[model samples]
Target: MENFVLILLAIVIGYIINRLNIFSKDAPTILNQFAIYISLPAMILLQIPKLSFSIDMIIPIIVAWIVMFISAILILVLSKFFSFSKEITGSLMLVSILTNSSFLGIPIINAYMGESAMPYVLVYDQLGTFIALATYGTFIASYYSNKNKITFKIMTLKVLTFPPFLSLIVALFLIGVEFNPVITKVLSSFASTIVPVALVAVGLQLQLRLPREEIKPFSVALIVKLIIAPLIAFIICKIFAWDNQASIVSIMEAGMAPMITAGAIASMAGLAPRLSTAIVGYGIIISFITTGFLFKIIS
Candidate 1:
């Protein structure tokens, strides 16, 4: 409950700050840069090294990948059907496919399923959503933000040079090697900033009154992210006969709000900033009710 309240409070504070003109228009961008550059890497270093992969992790990991891949393809086709611009298409790609599987997923899953289910949540998060944010998120930001024709070389370079991605690579190698307490503490302090910072960034740009043109895309994004994504995960679980806690966690994670980081990345890339922030802002609020109903149905 406290976690949920903290997220909402941070968003409210950001919105209030925006109204007060306390910061320049570049405030959201600066906060996002902090999240992507400093906090995200610190989180990766702090958490990834501690993960020990196991056979049990395969189901949630595979389920997460499948949901994202299918969702991405669907969003592309729908964007073309609706005649969305390259920027809108790119924004939808990031905000729809990547989910708030960690920030929102952790507490919500823990509340519904208990501590034993947490490992599955971590598996789906670190191995699933986190990797997508670093790779797919970076790719979309580069591909859409660039005006010139992009090549595989440039995309690869962008992903490689992305700070969080670089940290992920280093963290993977450091697995099984314990860090000194001082180093761990430092990393934790920085890592803790990711959620609040990202949420505040989202709030800073949140738009309540939308132009008629944006309504369709916003509605489409929410339906895809909060509804169809989880439905797909549920069907996959049923097909595989995964009648277990891991499957439950994976399905719920799929239904989470648009990733705070993904929306920040989309806005940072100038991919319809207002629409991206609105999708994230409204999505998180709506997810509270949707996720509870989802838990009841699945359980």
Candidate 2:
């Protein structure tokens, strides 16, 4: 409960900051850069080195991917009803299929399912979720933007420099090294900032206006995110008969709001920003009610 409440509080504070115009949009770029360069690397050092993978992790991973893939396919089916360009349709489908299972997923699981779930969650973030985002996400965004043409140089540069990817490599290195006090201190302090800065960064980037006409599209997107996504996770858990703890963690991570990174990618890809923002905001807001009741039920 402590973890869940803290994350919610941070998100609430972010919304407050956004409404108040605490900083211009320009300020968060630095924070985003800091998170990418400093906080993210620190987090990778702390979590990755300490991680130990397992075959059991594979079950949740496959479940997660299956759920996402199914949802993406569903979005494409629904897109036929709309008149959106292929780029917009692809971006919308991308966001619909993906969830924010990492930056925001950790604290929620830690609060409800306990720290035991972290390894499952971490591996999901690393290999399962991140890989999808890099390949599928980039493909959708770039394809929509008419930039899908890839040279070896572009692909190599993107994969190598991605912050999370870099962190994953560093973490693998940490697996064999002796833990040291100096590294711990630096990583601990810097990593501590990820949650707060990230939420506020969400706030900083948010613009509240959207076309009321697109409310139809927006609601459809949110329903997929908050309802369909979590339901699939729970159903997968039940089908596979995931044990109690893993089941709860699966639901929590799977229900997570849309990826914030999706917003950046969508904008860069020239997708509908209003639709993306609406999806992200609605998912976070509803998560409190839905996730709150959910944990109580599981408990």
Candidate 3:
């Protein structure tokens, strides 16, 4: 609970900084790039090598893919009723499919379930959500942009060149090798900045004053993300009879708010920037309440 409170406090601090105009508008972008390229990759390199391989490790990835495809299909069917613009639809796909599984999910699991849950959290983020973001996410962003043509080569290159993904590859190779304690400590020190930096960056970028027109689509997207997605994960766990602790963590991670990077992806792709930002900002606020309720129920 202290950990979760710290996460929220970091966000609040960032928000206050933004409100006070303490930094330029570009501060969030710079912070995001730093987290993605430096802190996040270091964190992955430190954690992934320590993880023992297991078939169970793949379940979280499978759950993520299931949610992504299911959300896509649902969005396609509901598009008719909503009469959403191409940009709004694209933003919806990004938010609903991807999750804040790493930044928010890790802390929540660590607080509630302890170090035992770390390996599963790492798998869900690195193998599952990360891959989905690099591949399917890129495809959706490009497809919706309509301005830039997406090629198979481009998509493959995006995945291969992503810093964290590259770090994951390196970590896998070093899995069984022992590292000097000093080196490991150094890496861990750099890695430790990820969560707070990420949350602060999210807060800096967040805009709570949403446009009236976007509320309906945003609400539906959150429903798929925070509600329906986890319900599906719970059902999957029951059917597969996964380990109880892993299943609970998986469900809770699935229930996380929209991905922080989703808005950046949408904006870069020339999709609905306003809608994407609105979803991310509002989603994070609401998730505080929803995830707390979920933790209570599952506990």
Candidate 1 per-residue lDDT over residues 1-299, each given as its tens digit: 77668777877888999999998999988988998789878877776676576645588899999999999999999999999999999999999999988666765676677656755776687678877776777778888989445466755676678787688788878878899999989988997787788778767866665657799999999999999999999999999888777788899999998898788789889999988988987888899899999999999
| lDDT winner, 2 or 3 | 3
Model 2 vs. true fold: TM: 0.86
Worst 10 residues of 3 by lDDT: 48-57
Overlapping backbone residue pairs in candidate 2 total: 0
Report how far residue 51 has shifted in candidate 1, in Å: 2.3
Give lDDT per model, in order.
Answer: 0.83, 0.72, 0.82
> Which candidate number has the best TM-score?
3
Q: Estimate the TM-score of every prediction.
A: 0.78, 0.86, 0.94
Model 2: which ten-residue window has the lowest total lDDT? 48-57
- Return the top candidate by lDDT: 1
Q: What would you estimate as the lDDT of candidate 2?
A: 0.72
Candidate 3, residue 252: the lDDT equals 86
Model 3 reaches what TM-score against the true structure? Answer: 0.94
For model 2 the local lDDT of residue 130 reads 74
TM-score of predicted structure 1: 0.78
Total backbone collisions for each predicted model: 0, 0, 0
